[model samples]
Target: MLYIIGLGLCDETDITVKGLEAIKSCERVYLEAYTSILMVPKEQLEKFYGKELIIADREMVESQSDEILLNANSLNIAFLVVGDPFGATTHTDLVIRARELNIPVTVIHNASIINAIGACGLQLYNFGQTISIPFFTDTWKPDSFYDRIKENKDLGLHTLCLLGKKIYEPPRYMAINKAIQQLFEIEETRNQKVYTTESLAIGIARLGSSTDQKIKVGTLNQLLSQDFGPPLHSLVIVGSRVHILEIDFMRFFAVDKQLYNEIVKKDYGI
Candidate 1:
């Protein structure tokens, strides 16, 4: 049997009881490292789980999956993923491939940023399409995501922007500042005025980590100057038709509550 386990957000202890049992019974355990990461290091997880893990980078998972799936017909194999196993489409593809090989699969689900972003006090149902903001290069800046955000805005729905991360290389994590800058640049080029410097946004850093998590709510310009200490940050673009309750709840995390209120009233007309 092949087990695809979700490690949840945060550290090793965040694994579900069923996932831990599966890990203990598995003959070989592979940790998928490229999609997202845990708050703790590999060694920490190994120490906690009492199992040595083989790190599966993007290359190995995509190009050499058969090697990882080897012997799964006879022996139990575990493929661990940060957040939920199905969070990334790559993992879904792997499951499809396993089915083609007639390998029985078991999935263990857990909390991911997709749902956990509600900590910012935004209603999950009110969110439109979720978009990923990739690290922009001088020659290749993509604004396709901006159109999605605009679509969400047009419908009075919030937009969740999942920042990009480059793992196994120099390790680049997109900051909220850079995301806002890219959005502004896209607006300048497109001139649709989907977003502006005074637009309200919420920046979350190191989410699900008890010790280092931070939440900041303010305008795009206000957040650009704030320092969100560590990696794994996400940005939320506030829709113009925000609920009063959401504004009230998120005000606690606002950089300046008065300013947040003023902007919400003036720009969002809430």
Candidate 2:
């Protein structure tokens, strides 16, 4: 049997009871290290899990999965994912390959940033599409994400912009400030007025961890200057459909209370 388990967001202790049991039963356990990461170190997770974990980078998972899946038909193997197993399409491809090899698979579900972003007080149903903002290069800047944000704005729906990271060559993660700067540059080039300095945005860092996680609500201009410590950040572009209850909840995390209110009322008309 091949088990794909979710580690959930944050530390090693976040794994579900079933996931832990599966880990204990498996002969070999591999941790997928590229898509997302946990707050604790690999040693900590291994100590808690009581199993030696093999680190699986992008190349190993994508190119050399056969080795990882070897003997799965005769023995139990565990593939651990940082968030929900299905959060990334790469895991789905793994399942397909496993099935083709006649290996039985089981996936253990857990909380991901997709649902956890509700901590910002935005309604889940009000969100349009989730887009990823990749690092822009001098010769290869991508503006496709801008269109998704514009579509969300046109529908009065919120947009969740997940910051992208390269596949662990240098382990660089996009910060909230950098993401905002990239968005502003995109707007400057396109001039669609999809978003602006006065547009409301929420910058979140270290999500799912109770201690280090930071959630800040303010305009792009307000949040661009604020410092969000550490990596693994996400940004949310507020829409016009924000509810009164949401406004009340978000005000607690605003950079400036009065300014947040003014943008919501004047700009969002909510």
Candidate 3:
């Protein structure tokens, strides 16, 4: 049997009750370190789980999965993900391969950033297509996400931006500043009004951690200069008018109140 377990968003304690049980029972436990990560260190998780787990990097998972799955025929092997197991597609492929090998599989789920961004004071149901902002390289800047953000804005729906996380090495998180810059650069070239520096946005960081934070009613200009702190962050761009209660709730962590209020009225449709 192969178990795909979700470690939730913050720390080791965030693991679901069922997932923890499987981790303790599994013969070999592996942590998928690439896609996303908890706020705590791997050492903390080992102490909590009471198991000697192997760290699986992208190279190993993509090239040496058979090595991890080799002895699972009679043993219970578990692959732990930082968020809900299916939040990333790489995890989905692992399950498919396990099925081909006739291994019975079970998924233990938990909170994922996909639905966790509601803390930004926006209604979850008002969200449209979610897009990822990738790290721009010198020669390969891509802004294809602009079209989707525009499409969502046109419909009066919010846009959730899942900033890219690279797991090939130790996980490297893309900051919101870089994301905004890349988006505006593309908008600049395309002559598009889809997104601009003055566009209203929200930045949330460390979603499930004790010190988790949210900054509401910021513009691309204000948001780009602000640091949300830590990795594993996400940003949201509100499409149009929403319940004023949402804005009031998010104001508790407002970084730049005067500017935020201005943008919220002009862009967020107050």
- Scored by TM-score, the top model is 2
- Residue 52 shift from truth in candidate 3, angstroms: 0.8
lDDT of 2 by residue, 174-263 (tens): 999999999999999999999999899999998889889999999899889999998789999998887889999999999999888787
Instruction: Give the distance in Å from residue 192's predicted Cα in candidate 1 to where it truly belongs.
Output: 0.5
Better of 2 and 3 by TM-score: 2
Tally clashes: model 3. 0
In model 2, where do residues sit more than 4 Å from their true spots?
A: 168-170
Candidate No. with top lDDT: 2
What local distance difference test score does each model get? 0.88, 0.90, 0.81
Position 244, candidate 2: lDDT? 88
* Tens digits of lDDT, candidate 1, 1-270: 999999988988889999999999998999997777787899999888888999988888878889889989899999999998766444866787789899999999988888899999999999999999888899999889989999999998999999886644544689898888888889999999888898889999988888888999999999999999878899999886678898889899999989987987787667
How many clashes show up per model? 0, 0, 0
**Model 1 spans with C-alpha error above 4 angstroms:** 166-171, 268-270
Better of 1 and 3 by lDDT: 1
Instruction: Give model 2's TM-score versus the native structure.
Output: 0.96
TM-score for each candidate, following the candidate numbering: 0.95, 0.96, 0.92
Question: Per-candidate RMSD vs. true structure?
Answer: 1.6, 1.3, 2.0
**What digit string (tens of lDDT, one per residue) describes model 3 on residues 49-97?**
9998899887788788787787788999999988888775447667777
Alpha-carbon deviation at 105 in model 2, angstroms: 0.5
